[model samples]
Target chain A: MATTRKSARTTPAAERPHPDATRRSQRSRQAIYAAALALVGEVGYPKTTIEGIAARAGVGKQTIYRWWSSKAEVLLEAFLDLGEQAVHAQGQEAPYAIPDTGDIAADLKAVLRATVDQLYDPRFEAPSRALAAEGLVNEQLGREFVAKLLEPSLQLHVDRLRAAQAAGQVRPEIDPRIALELFVSPLAQRWLQHTAPVSYAYTDTLVDYALHGLAPR
Target chain B: MATTRKSARTTPAAERPHPDATRRSQRSRQAIYAAALALVGEVGYPKTTIEGIAARAGVGKQTIYRWWSSKAEVLLEAFLDLGEQAVHAQGQEAPYAIPDTGDIAADLKAVLRATVDQLYDPRFEAPSRALAAEGLVNEQLGREFVAKLLEPSLQLHVDRLRAAQAAGQVRPEIDPRIALELFVSPLAQRWLQHTAPVSYAYTDTLVDYALHGLAPR
Candidate 1:
């Protein structure tokens, strides 16, 4: 029975399940994601366990173990799915890509304004802060969060800046990697530490200061 | 007896005891500071208690209570003293001001480089990360850390930038509050998130990119 169950779990798409089976699988995945996020937000990362997630999702422990290895793995993928859903809800084309509308400053400001909304969203804030707080003390988890979540988002900016360089909007000699941080890091600092409230106006000012220099033009 | 003990605890400096009593007081203070840092580093902020700190310091619980009302108060003053000790160890003037050599860019880079050293210091890293991790989850503590610890350090940069504005080294139109973040926030992000390695060269690049437009001259 165990052998048969393991085989069923790893079955390929080409082997084709019934329509009912596919629908059930999709529903289970969604339930698991929702349970993981809600549990983490409520109890924080340290207390959140696979058992709790399974219980909350009304799935067997083997069901989660068959899909993912650890709680961190589940949460990471859940956040990625959350970002995709947020983008889809916004009707954005190419959900993860930064926009390049010829004017680098204006484009960057628009995306940062969108980020302000996401950061302040009640659905996103609690779970994100819980995970972020864990990441601060857990080096292994912190590195994973940076690698899977943050670096990809930052790369979008890097790619946009590189394109700006090619179009003569940015200096050819400037390092796109470092240049992106001038605006990106300040907003990140505000969100992570709650040093100050973030706003469309504040991010707009960051882009202006970053592009035009803080000294005389 | 209770009144006598309380009076002894609150004795004014003019009515203080002899030299041996003063030396013993200093020793107890140092032990308490060391114990607070170690306990926070080991068990993290939430689990660390005033009782644990007193036990670890080999002092009576009342000794700690006599000096500080709570663990947060003890840790805050301990961290403040730690910063002062670091500055003194660096052989700089007391209250370690940011240098002003007329070149705003160079001065900012120099100070950030010193900060990079301090952030990576072994003695500072574990306890600081523990407190910071707690701050992310505890809103009240988070605000207190920002207002008491972070804002004071940031205000020094504001003062330096305002001086630069007066000297015509920086654009008068730029808000010194926001302008300082260009150099400061990147280093902060790198440390807090371990997003990247920070060094003198990296900070120097930030100052140059911040002061000169990323577009061609």
Candidate 2:
């Protein structure tokens, strides 16, 4: 993965000054992103340095510093890029937005199921675990990752819930921020802490329980 | 805290014919626990050594090896002892049991609120964070801690939920294990990641949402 990224970075520089240069830059950027993710997964966050990432990507240290200020910044962007790639690989639109087919529960369940697949994917699992483990010990880095990489995704759910509320599907009194966690955090805890296996069925059940109270109706 | 625990440990020995024997033994044990918690919290799990702990405790290396086989065992027991002391200090029964007030929601909210207090308490915060952070990276220690410290407490919630189920309060089909996470994981995430502020209101909302569901009835 790192070698592929490094070679890809140089491809654009070899090309001419027109649209091909732009394409090469795009390819190099993607390569850097992939290298960052792969290296972090292999070495973990603390041991993953910009110098190592540059060495792995076959780029100068200046290339990484020019793009990202720190290792955390690189990883966050790398994760964001990975999410986009995952969406693209799924044959969805480039910047994957949650679909609202006028069925809020169905939309939420579908997204969570997709998330389970992403979490379980071998390519994403190890690096994400490393970054998450570091986040547990490093408060500032944890908060930054949550704000940049996590909160954006969570806000998408919040937006969906708000739309549900407007349609009279969700309770007006519900705090969508916390409401999203009803399903999200359970899956997150299971994945991060090795507390349980995450599956479409488990997340589906979570959505059902969150949408319908655990208590008898 | 170490002084108190050490004094308690030596009380039996002090009662012996040798008047100073009890005080000496108590001091040693207290020093060991304090040293263990501090070392683990400061340097983290893999780096913490029994010899290091003994040296810090002002005891011979054999002292720790005599009681515990590894640093993991010593740290685990130290945490258990700390929890017991925390509960005792709160005037609660040692090995604290969650209250059963028949109203499942109220009981759950109360317990979660107490948990919020404990998670934020300065004495418990740093050391627990250090261990939990290590658990994220070390699967063996993570599972052991979960089984020994977390699961027992989680089971009490399960037992309470079962009672609620029998009382026609909770839905009969609900799995208490997963159901518990709706309330528990949110707080755990906030504490673990510093994603958000945890409070009585937050926990109360979680209980209400977990019981009542987010959708309009």
DockQ, all models: 0.75, 0.74
RMSD of each: 3.9, 5.6
lDDT of 1 by residue, A5-116 (tens): 5797788867757889879978998899999999998999999999999999999989899889999999998999999999999998888998888989889999999988
TM of chain B, each: 0.91, 0.86
Best by TM-score: 1
lDDT of 2 by residue, B1-217 (tens): 4666567755775463464765876778778988988987787766788889998999998877867788888888888888888888888863567777789989998899889988888767877888888787678988899889888888988988999999999999999999999999999998998888888999999999999999987
lDDT of 2: 0.86
- DockQ for candidate 2, C-alpha atoms: 0.74
- The ten-residue window of minimal lDDT in model 2 chain B covers B13-22
- Tens-place lDDT per residue, model 1, B1-217, is 3776579768987786778986998899989998998999899999999999999999999999988899999999889889999999989885858999999988998998899898889888889999988888798998899999998999999999999999988899998888888888998888888888888999999999999978766
